[model samples]
Target: MKNKTGRYSAYIRPFSYFIDLAIINLFAILLLSENVYSIYFVVFSSLSWVIIALNVEFYEVYRYTKIIAIGNKILKQFALFTIICFAYFGIFSNHSNARETLIYTLLTLLVVAFAKIFIYYFLRKYRRLSGLNYRKVVLLGSAKQVKQLASFFNDNPDYGYHLIKIFSTDIDKKLAIEMCCEFTEKEEIDEVYCSLFDLSNLQVNELVNFAEDNNKIIKFLPDNKNYFARNLKVDYYGYIPILSLHKTILHDPLTKLFKRAFDIFFALITIIFLLSWLTPLLAILIKLESKGPVFFKQGRPGIDEKEFFCYKFRSMRINATTEKEASKNDPRVTKIGKFIRKTSLDEMPQFLNVLIGDMSVVGPRPHLWSQNKVYGNKIKKYMVRHFVKPGITGLAQVRGYRGEIETDVDMVNRIKYDVYYIKNWSIILDLKIIFLTVFNIFKGEEKAY
Candidate 1:
């Protein structure tokens, strides 16, 4: 729990998965390949395993995960895997005998299940004995649930949660919250536990912002009076329920991999087929009307509030107020810039940003640093938009919330759409947004400029 190498604990689950996959494929080649193509079986079985595992969250075992939960996951995975194995034979028209196939699957699952449970209990024993893979956590508030949680952490060392301190807000709430933030910053606290019944909306927001900004996990200890929102994930540590902010779909490794692969493919096609020739053509037009760079690059806040330079075709003249948003018939915009911006051509350069991993094809548009600063504090959950990569075209843009935030309401609506997109993201939704974006560009949006 106190090992310096404990920071690498995040890789352990993925490593276990790799080992399991190896065992599966090896068993397939050895036992199930007599009458079938070994390579085909290996490929099909491997893909099936990964897909089923992800669906069942087979590798999400945690320190507090019950043995019964692990068994449940194993059973679910094995059941689905068995079905896929039979379906594989039917689809490929292989004549492998049913009894032989069943035996091979049963053997493979037995070995895989053994490895899974071994790693799970081994980590528990390792943490309890050596104190190696532990998380340093701090508690906030003085609610009854908070006290129970603190006791739970103290009583269960095998869970690997080392309680650093408890900052009780009973005496002086404001000062205690401030001191807790300072202590968290100074110490190596991995997680913050806030009791929902003891803190106000403002205090909870402050704690959430501090935790997110510093890359620490923040969880809420909900009281019976509080409603359990759909956006919060509920986990049980013994009989006590802990609520965590639900992570978006993009947080899943498989989902991220698929989205990234799609982004690269889309960006490559756009660059090769369109941007290859269009860049120089727009370059001349931009240069003829403006005495500045052909491409405009500005720092924008991306995922996790990290700053990155976003690229666009230069649509405005050299100006002192480059950070300011453009207005209707603004003198700063060049003739070519007007056309390009109106036609959504200026954003074409961001395909390179997508290719380089700075952005996505469809997401919340990256905001100027100035806009983030202005709206971040004024609007609740404004910074939540940064939870995912900014995009070239987004749901908000297609919904007529793009360009020139004329009022705070415009940004509020945009944030609503952005959060919706993040919470309910899918490949079909992304493709739909892309289609709408193209249609918007051709049909001309009212706020295009």
Candidate 2:
């Protein structure tokens, strides 16, 4: 079910990286050989270029990336790199000439930028003329926007998206969707372009699940009314805009690494400083109050809808209604449960879940598997929250969507916030949610029963 790429296409970026490094070091040695510490300059410049490139996403140029975007990246990388080069000499007290350093930086960046632009256009021309490196894409829906998108794909072969088939939703909707999925699976389709206006919410959900399960890329053609939807990356094919479902900043490998590192660090601190002693005290209270274990583990879906046992302090006495959410004055709540739930102390044990890598320190809070099944069918895009690891505390919880869901509106609003958080996630946003959560714990939320 894996999507296939051209034989040498995958190596292009890595080759570009190697070539850029060579250019940088070669220029440094050639232009700054007068300095005794030329080797240091080479290493410093090489590392700086890579780090800067990652931050600026310099190598993220794709077939869909515009020339203007490439130029912008080049200018950004050059500016930042120029700063790094000058700072190195200032810090190390190297006697390299200022003019020579400027020349080296300029020549190195020019060559790298030229190589990047050349590859970008070369791929475009190659795809158009040689008919290689093209993705086998299926278009679904019969909306006007979808028609325009199909036309764009047909007109611009240089973009490397081969329009395999178009399944019109104007006919029998269910049959069309089924046929689309079947064809996609049979043909080894690389991507599916769906029009939001043509498909129902449930149908869209099914497509999303199918794409996830089958390892196919799914994008949406947002209608004119919903063009400004949040949490999706919009890519322009000429004047037409297409929305990508999984293009969030979190989708970046480096970004995921940073978030995972942060999660581990934060989980360890909480476990060592808070939970280590707190768990023993909490366990004694729970045992005295009830006859069951101190910790309660409930099956919940994590990232990709995979089942994992979510950990929490035993907040409820052993009851037949463990799957049911606790209301304001539910009979299942133990005396200790009331206090822990109010103070948000019951969720502290989930640091273990975070440490174990089944969850995150900050993300959409995992719900009961039963609740997920119900709401996932009831609400549109409700399951999108599972795209990231469920969290102990989340944007929805901090925004007062925590605890019992009394109405469908409550869950709908919660899903909105969850989607927004996923789309707009940043390290700073995670910190803000943590801060707001702490504030809510003390200030007392009305629904934190």
Candidate 3:
């Protein structure tokens, strides 16, 4: 009694990747010369892309994730593909045309990236709006987490889970068991999500046996106490298993190295190409407009709540009193300051902060020391953003959560985006934020003062 529609679930992603790479190789052959080594190039590139993508679980769609997350996974897989191509061409190949080979690789990757984006969004919308394909799912047992899961399924039809029935402790135990068995026996339910915290071992065994006998998938929902354990990896040491949540993706050694490399590369380009002329010009403007230093250097919290000097082009008249947060049409903003702040050119000097390793090009933006203390006490998990170095522009800023915290709702929403950024850190996400930031600057965000 195998499931009919999802039977080929495992093959879908691999098949797509295979087709994409095949097209890329065919194009490369038609565009470039058809050398004897072309076959080897296709084989190596396809294998590398598939292997790396599988290792990263890049194709496994998480039901709760956003489309941006899917795009992030695609870009990360392509990044790995680019690396493998580099290794093959630079280290192993005897060809003198390494640059040309890299160019072909880049073009292929770009094509596949666009293809993945279309497939991901288009298929999701088709499935949701057309109501074409959906998995029949049932909930078992009772817990707060179970309700949360149910709410999520109801809210996101794009996830393709159709809830049929819920059997919980509120119902008679015997009747609940009977209904569960009946559901499985009829082959009406494709999967069962059971919360085991309150269930007896016998009850759990009964549910498991019924699911196995009916060829239905079973997933266990952790207790509400473990709600915060979203992204932790489980590991086994010999026979004993361990649940560890201390490490996050951004804190991984390889991830840190890769992000640091990107930060340096981006910072160097900005400094040499754009900032070299812009900084001197802005410095003179600030000097002529205001009676303070060219740069406003203030202490702000960085990773792990450590203090760092955050630099920005001075965008306000020197205030001897308490530095209150900027308001709409604040008189403290100088003429030059208003233009720089509105254009976000004031944040340009933070590239120096990025270059010096005090900050990143993208992460949670650091707040002033006073604001940090105030928000730390007011908001839950406010300090979690400190897990990674602060950035010049961040998820919250690009998402239009920047500027003065007019109310508690603003602060809370800002923290929510910050926490999300920390949990879902990726190079592609960083690049997306940077792209949005540029667009926002040009469009002129309403909050910009």
Candidate 4:
């Protein structure tokens, strides 16, 4: 049942984690004492936990599972965690951390690890007692796909999804046979998942109508291998049906919160600390170079095709306009602008853009209205890039796509990288991009005239 797994499923793991973390942190404090080595132990333990847990993918939580599976997985992951702990510390330890302290920490961590499992076991049992049932549903997919879905349902109990039938066909004759074969005259199906691939428009319509007639919730999970969705999963739950398709990965709530929060937090810090101090000096330089506003502003297409005034330091002569593209050796770029563009100091004003919540610290760099004009018509899925707020630096920028949009192919490839970044946005990925950006700023930075 969605009711049981909805909030409780999330809380269970986080609760288990906090309990384990508290136990480990408290033990480290008590036993390791006021030593820098204690920090190492905590870090080692945390790293070990994530590494082992991540490899097992239990945290993904896509289905319900049995107690045996949960208990066994916890055991396996915790064992891996402990092994990594010993091996990591063994290689890196100095003379101070005696075998006694190490043994105590290990014993303490083992208690915490088993506690995590025991806690889950208790919670699962309590939940079962509470009648926390999975959402009863039926599958409408190919044989292979339906079997895989059924197996997944059977395997992962935490998911809280119970597949009641494998309705592998979507045809009317076959559908009737399936209905007759799988369900008796009195049976009611709560949900009909149409995971069948390569269905014609007529077949899709028929299946949709059938689900609607039965008052059954229908969910379509397209094959991941076929990436073309024409922006399939965007548009705010289909209330506003537009010609364009949206990339769904960017709209995932955690990914959205993470990317936006990173943009806002780092943007504010930069605005207050770095940009605040740097702006005045840059303004003075720009004013001296030419008689124009120190900061440049232009309307850029943002998320959902919304328009916002993007900011940047004026990196060209006053006569340079928004419609003009930046050239490698443009005459409009001032002597100081040349230096700034080469060093990427010009993009410093985008910290304000970042703070305004119009851009990211690192993402698919926003394009001007005119460039979007040129490429939006030319590139397929070009408009989907607006699914999320654009960034100042992105996968494209670091991977040598920043400078000039020389060709349609260049923009296409650039969009490919942007889509890749959009699909794979994470805190760790952002951190890696930021690190790479810093490295590039100092090591072979591209000249953005």
Which candidate comes out best when scored by TM-score?
1
Question: What is the descending TM-score order?
Answer: 1, 2, 3, 4
Give the poorly placed runs of model 3, Cα more than 4 Å off: 1-243, 321-323
Q: How much RMSD separates candidate 2 from the native structure?
A: 8.3
lDDT of 3: 0.74
Residues 1-449 of candidate 4 have per-residue lDDT tens digits of 01122432545656666776777667767665364356677777775665566567445432334445656676676567656655765676654455646665577657864775566566556544553644666766577645665676566454455667666554553564347324621354545655536355566566654543333445555655443453344211112111113335566545555566778888888778887778899889989988788888888777655678888788787774757777877888898888888888888888887876777788778887788767764666575577677888889888888887887778888888987877777678889988898898888665455
Worst 10 residues of 3 by lDDT: 235-244
Q: Taking the tens digit of each residue's C-alpha lDDT, what string does model 2 give over 265-378?
A: 999999999998999999999999989999899888787667889988998989888788999898889999999999999999899999889999999999887887678657
Q: Please provide, for model 1 over 389-439, each residue's C-alpha lDDT reduced to its tens digit, 9 standing for 90 to 100.
A: 999989988888999999999999998898899889999999999999999
Higher-TM-score candidate among 1 and 4?
Answer: 1
Lowest summed lDDT window (length 10), candidate 4: 235-244
lDDT for each of the candidates? 0.85, 0.85, 0.74, 0.65
Stretches off by above 4 angstroms in model 1 are 1-23, 38-43, 98-107, 110-136, 143-145, 151-164, 172-191, 196-218, 222-233, 245-300, 306-340, 352-358, 369-374, 404-410, 423-432, 443-449
Residue-wise C-alpha lDDT for candidate 3, range 218-257, written one tens digit per residue:
6666544553354434432222222323456887645876
- Total backbone collisions, model 3: 0
Determine which window of 10 residues in candidate 2 has minimal summed lDDT: 1-10
